[model samples]
Target: MSTDLSSTPPGSPGAPASDKLDRHVLVIAGVVVLGAIMSILDITVVSVALETFQREFDATTAQVAWTMTAYTLALASVIPLTGWASDRFGTKRLYLIAIVLFSAGSALCAAATSLEMLVAFRVVQGLGGGMLVPLGMTILTRAAGPERLGRVMAVMGVPMLLGPIFGPILGGALIDNASWHWIFLINVPIGVATIVYAAIVLPKDDVEPSETFDWLGMVLLSPGLAAFLYGVSTIPETGTILDAEVLVPAIIGLLLIAAFVPWALSRRNAHPLVDLRLFQNFTLTIAVIAMALFAMAFFGASLLFPLYFQQVRGEGALDAGLLLAPQGLGAMLVMPLAGVLTDRIGPGKIVLVGVAVITVGMGMFATLDAETSYYFLTGALFVMGLGMGATMMPIMTAALQTLRGHTVARGSTLLNIVQQVAASIGTAIFSVLLTNGVKNEADPTALALGEIEDESQLRAFLEQTGIPAEQLPTILRDLTDDLAGVFSGTFWIAAAMVAVVLVPAFFLPRKPPAEPVDQTALMGH
Candidate 1:
């Protein structure tokens, strides 16, 4: 039986009452999309501005990086609290509060006088931003009902996917035309409008009877996730997982997380922090497995795209961001159709096709070299985008469709945690691979260029390395070609991971259930 009674039954749990999303649901989706845009865009926009922050604060690379890391750590720590908080306090009230916190944090960030102050403000921003996605999913899922979940999710997916592609372009334009503060300041007005819109438009959700707070699970999971992600985030900079900075926290984090699993599985805690019980749904379990594989392979390889444009082709940050637009365009073109097809046939058939398309696109990237044509590269990206638009949201729909009542919130939260963790691990793994590749191929002169910030340091660094100054031009040219090979090889690895997603995807529900399964009945097993 369905637990959430917010919306009247359409036709059946698995079938839509109507083919189109009604006006009320559309309004709710709009509010969710607005909040999502602010949260998702901030991650990438701030990333593009890291160099600017470094120069402005006169900080070392490691110190400046904390601006990004602190935000991420804060995000990982707070996400576990969202599903519980939404159930304890109503979703609308919590949604508005999150906006206020995010907005206030953004304002404080803009006014910060030092790097430490900026990092502190970012933590506040992260706490608010972390809740937006899962909460948004809960709000939309409850309002749209199961029949239209795919389409509404597709609408939400647009900003989620586009944020990474467009954030750098927006960040670069603002940095060049304005100042670094604009990135943070940009969120203020949007946040204000979202608050007002949500306050007026979103239907009030009743707070469910609160369950006993999972204090032990929170202690185990929050720090475990924060410590784990902090370590993973450092891997790209440290260039190896073996480093003390990476190993110590990562190992400790893993052990703590391992402890959390059994504790959550125990029968004593009726309401666990993350609700691992939802995995009892076979369709949801397979969907998340496929999602993890896809996220690792696709998002991991995506990190290299801008680097390829900027470092190898020598495009400016703005130009590199612009060059990647075709991928976003391709995703936009296909997502709505994919959503429709998922609602009709089931996510299984569509996902298999999506994975195949992504593999083809990735295969094209795997062959890349320094002299590869831009037309061919853009075409490949467009093809991949089409696949991505089809793939990501459908997987989410597959995980969420069967769960009833509060289980919807639990399912969304679990799906998000898996995606975030998988993407982080994948990024770290691929980054280390590429870094090693470049290091192995480059000589002392090539490595020195990365270390030297100014002309004064260049001569001294060359003297220290004992490389002839006369060969600099030739070394730069050769290093560029070497970088291309390293990236190509890494893309091949990413392509293989994408292919692995198919194994789990093969088990996703092949057709929408003629009737919704009783999720309550499955929870006992």
Candidate 2:
């Protein structure tokens, strides 16, 4: 009797029994991590460069902001296509293509001469970057197998967690010492190395017959998601969700997204662009909900961390980034242990504890004042990092552990898209709240002074306006304290949202499945 090795799922009775990741899997992980670092890091890296772009291009803040916004919108637009493309072209081939496309886009972005040109180039870069993370997850998950997923996922989570912390430090160093162009130029060499390494070290694709492409669903979802995210991205600038720029596109996007649900569920469309049918898995659904809430609360509030340092504490970009390092350090210390624990016991208990820890950390931030000690703030960040290390990857392991065969690709895609959307919404909501709060707290005269970028600028304004020198200390003290209060209030909301993640986390699987996952049962094949 002959057995089909290719047909066997990892962790199945007939498949390899070892729970540890071997050298081959480790090498594959290296390749995936390299690509993931580039993709995730780009999002935060450009955030610090916005002011530089504004100066270089002589553009308004809103126009310069498009450098980030365009990339985000383009990234969201292309993600739905990844699952189907992965299946059709194979992960290995598609991965290489994504790397090449991203590298080319990066090169073009560095060479851009105008704001318009840069925005167009960012769209190209985003299209390429869009596929990297989901595809990396799919590759690593299949390579490491279900039994070793927690460890491997912990490895993957490093980039996701550290990107925000390190991006500013790196971006600031490069722009301060080198120039803004180096930010994009730096990726060129890394991308080249990643492409070559991936082509050689990555396994060959095992292609299957392709399904018919879902053109109709693509029309409804991609544009819909892009429009919605664009509106949300503008919220910080618009200051309200009710503005025409925010509302018109958001409502239209929602209508289109609403239409997609039924179209995806229709029997006539055998292959939807994004398979909503996957949500039918009870475990998968709950895990995704928990992930969405965690991401919304954590990522949304994280953007404020550096802003608080720069605006209120009078720190430079690099200094703010360095101060935030404790959070990343905390996450690093616990991620590996969290991974192993998830493998031994299911993700439920681990994630519940993680959310609670995060709630505590955020609560600490809610009480922050301009005079709060650095030691106290860093300590709180470290505690939050511990929770994050335990939370994100374990939640992911829970979501993908039960998925078998082809569902792995689609599942990863779904998770990435949900994370992106949730983070965007959270950012917009928190930003609007903080902006409104600041408006209410400051006196009208202080508000009219506009943003004071530095002490020199503030000094110049005070001297020119003939304000009394005696009142300088009072003015600075009140401004900083009020700004700190706005931040503290916003974090209170973040704490509450983090706590809400507990509801879905409670429903996650508590123990590893006794039987190897049944692919047919989950997929209804």
Candidate 3:
């Protein structure tokens, strides 16, 4: 992996780009898409399967959460370095290797019998998975060039746009009909096929051996990011910020990132892990910030929604996925139009409208209670889907509008790193809030009146509190109805976070694209 890798020539690895590429390009695109599909599915597939995992492993919620956290942390940490890896190793080589690694990790995860081993396997998968998106973008950039970027991105968005939707559905179906292990087993064949195909098709770019890497920058940047992400993921979401589990690591991580900023900025020349100077481009900086906030707010809802549907509202996994499908479908419906809108009207107006719509959708969700009808929830999800579709593509397109071909992949990688980090943090924050909300909403009076102390005792008391022994079940139903108010408060917090995204959105430049910037320049020391 440390070997010096110069890029291949501009043409196909073994033949002319014009003729050799047509068939080969499809193979390359399939491989790239395959890689992305594997990663994307894992992100959401775990949602439905988490219950199965807990039952099989006899785990607690906090322990099980690590399964999700482990993969995301590893993925977020490695995304920053993808540009350098691709530049050094070439896209085809890196893509094939990543796929094989991911497939191997998938098999290991399926076979794991212990919680620790499963989490560790996911980390391996994440490391390989992290490299796929950027390299996939690189493959497209190399094969299609800027003229075809719009069409290429639009087509490529299919898997990314649908990953969240399909993941839950697949997980639900597999877990219900077969076993949780199948969720992972599904990736194996796809990865192997992709590896074989990419080895044959992906174009190799001419590598300039003259480019120097900032080794010091990577050392500082990677750990700082990993620590920050780990800390964010560990926020004992049910506890307060000052809770030892939440505050200690978070403070340490924050300090590290604080240290990273000054360290990177001081490096005056050569490649940096993240080129700090890229922020000098106002739109690019704004775009990056937008992506972070977008991820934080959006992914936050993702955690809450499923839980609300399944645990609170009592829907099954497949039903939850079916319920959530509107969001993905709506995004797919609007993506192409978003591409055209960005090309025509600039990102500002589109983003403003999208943000507004998302706020409205989330706001409606905030109003939900345990009693809120499922029909209303579905409507809100669709609106969220629309708003998400309307602007994110435009923002991503706008972010890279000024970047060069080779640099586009790198810039996108940086954007993805920030977005993933924000997502992990967002999930953590939401978890904390949800836990607090549930605890707070549990009536102190009811708790005091009941003689039970532990959760089991409280559950038993609540089960028969008002009962003439035979009527206990009916009384418990009444208690559940009364608890509706508590869940609504959780919705309020979720809505508030979504609304907060509007703040950063106000400053997005309405201006058109100027000169195209070099994407590689953003990789800083």
- Per-prediction TM-score: 0.95, 0.95, 0.85
Candidate with more favorable, higher lDDT: 1 or 2: 2
Q: How many backbone clashes does candidate 3 have?
A: 9
Q: What residue runs in model 2 are displaced by over 4 Å at the alpha carbon?
A: 1-16, 448-466, 514-525
For residues 1-525, write the lDDT of model 3, one tens digit per residue. Answer: 111112324453322233222554566567677788888888888877776778889999878888988888788778878877777777777787788889999999999999999999999999999888877876775665443343345556667767877789989888888888999998898888877777766665566563467676677677777777766767754366666766676677677667667665675645556656667767778888887888887776677777777655767779878888888887888767764454444567778788888888888887877678878988898898888876565666666665765566667787777777787777777778776765666554443433344777656665665534565455445445544555566667666776666666666655544446654454432
Query: How would you order the candidates by lDDT, starting with the best?
Result: 2, 1, 3
TM-score of candidate 1 versus the correct structure, residues matched by position? 0.95
In model 2, the worst 10-residue window by lDDT is 1-10
Clashing pairs in 2: none
RMSD of each: 3.4, 4.0, 6.9
What C-alpha lDDT do the candidate models reach, one value each? 0.88, 0.88, 0.71
Query: What lDDT tens digits, residue by residue, belong to model 2 across residues 338-445?
Result: 877777677898899999999999999899999999999999999999999999999999988877677888889999999999999999988998899999997655
CA lDDT for candidate 3:
0.71
